[model samples]
Target: MWHAVKTLNAHNGYVCALIAKVARYSVSAALRKESVALVYKSHGDPMQVLKLQKLNLPALGDSEVLIKMLAAPINPADINMVQGTYAVLPELPAVGGNEGVGQVLEVGGHVTSFRPGDWVIPRDAGLGTWRKELVLKEHALLRVPSDIPLACAATLSVNPCTAIRMLSDFENLQPGNSVIQNAANSGVGQAVIQIAATKGIKTINVVRNRPNFQTLTEYLQSLGADYVITEESLRKPEMKDIFKNIPHPRLALNCVGGKSATEMLRHLQHGGTMVTYGGMAKQPVTAPVSSLIFKNVKLCGFWMTQWKRDHEHEMGELNEMISSLCSLIRQGKLKAPAYTEVPITDYKTALENAMKPFSSSKQILVM
Candidate 1:
């Protein structure tokens, strides 16, 4: 009887030890699967609505890829979307960012376009980029070269693409031709200036009169702008000689509407095209009937989102453009815009910082 009792006690002790080991293993596995995301249940003030939530990342599906985010830029359209003013809005309880670069951590059995460790960005805007980790279908991501700089990759899809499209699609421009643009200090404007310079085209850049106008002018000039003038100077007589250095602009890019846009139109050569991409002034783009009739200038508008929808651009074309841009970046012919990196945990600080005026640097959320 004593021997039987001793054997039963020993067996019970072994069973308890095994249970504890299983519990510990389960806990460790759960910790490995945890992730964090910036999410909003509704659209309103971004700082007020965004929340950081903890979640367990789901297992990869047959056609899905698990992405670990690297970096995302805070764009004006993102802010507008959060405020419910953008032309397109994501569903409720959505992620915050629209564009970013991510590293693939895993790929599902059926996934083909990507492999583990590949770099990718969302094919289009509004893929919920402001998260530590996410799972997306294989087709939803645009794979970029692994060797490209991460910061350049993070911002590659929007501003640079917009500039390239506007420069190419608007008018038939050749080497030695000239282009003019307002908001030349902006990301797209800067891109246009550098890109045009690379192609042997000239740019007449117009910027607002700021306290540091001289410093800003020098900065844009350093980026290969043929000429940089103040918005107020666009109406002055001195602009003609500036045009004489090149020629009357054949294509004028207008981002700031109202009187500034009209003044830009005044510089347009006969039969020129002025493309309006944004209206920061919240005012209408009013053109004098005389200029439109006498000068034969054409007025047009470009929204990158709409352009994406209408064209249905294939990946090969985008990949080729991105590769060319990447080469330019590598060779120092193109410079990525200055950016301020904010950690994901302090997203509120990032959102607020992005709205500040005269900062001169984009606020990027880094995970």
Candidate 2:
């Protein structure tokens, strides 16, 4: 089979041109079915082409499995990658989505852990998940609990993993220790707040002022946010006095870079660490050298890919942590991220909605 695939690639147009020579032979009808996929051809282009074309079900490798994508989300990272701004770039004409929940349809002969009908989620990023179906190496997928909602499971891979890493990587936060973060209304930010609450930690969330700021704050507070403040409020003269009452957070998570990062750093205690996970502001993180030298502050960055590669030994631990979070959902201790479901048939509209500014809800592509 591998030799046949290689031959097909090698012959290319020649084989098709010479099809008359083999027209008598019958081909399998299964090869004629079409599937819709989001294909990217160029970077920095506003147009995204979706193609519905015939594709044979990929033959399984010794360690591969075939899956039907159940749901996927349009994360900021997905958009960044599509726009060619992300650090990693896949070959052109590639499909765009990093996270998805799927159900296994077939498994290779040697596969031991999964079978048909089992639900799974991609364990890594850039697996071309924005399609009706996929064929991936067995190890690239993680089995999701059956009880987890398909929509929530679709977003589990990126935001939830990020939240877990942010809370675990910094100082071992105790029950009373507080942490500050910008973009507190974001998916990862919300996950962080809930996870921290589960661990008995406090969070000071900062978000841009919106018409529903009061309602938003109340919503976050319901998720166990110790305090929620607007970014504008952080610049007030009374901010310094407010700090005296709230413990100086020893760790900070900054998703919004630029001046917002600098402001977040100000709320950290001396000798504290601030990890920049994203640059949502499209600007560089600028912090005074005096803070690093005199205050002994530490600035770091986190890329989930690098972290996962370095900590392969902790896969079991990571799975356990996610399972615990799922348990919280079952007990109503953790609230799922607010989201709007977009049917896959109207993918263009979904993408447009995802690109809209200041949306309170995440956009999910429901299959």
State which candidate has the highest lDDT: 1
lDDT of 1 by residue, 12-130 (tens): 24321110000001122224475677877787999898899865566666888888999998888788767776555655556778788999999989998999999998776666688
TM-score, structure 1 vs. true: 0.88
lDDT of 2 by residue, 10-106 (tens): 1123321101110000124334234456667665642355433324454556687878888888888788767776656555555767788999988
Residue 220 alpha-carbon offset, candidate 1, angstroms: 1.3
Model 1 clash count equals 0
The true-versus-predicted C-alpha distance at residue 135 of model 1, in Å, is 1.1
Q: Give residue 15's error in model 1 in angstroms.
A: 65
The CA lDDT of each predicted structure is 0.79, 0.75
Error of 1 at 149 (Å): 2.2
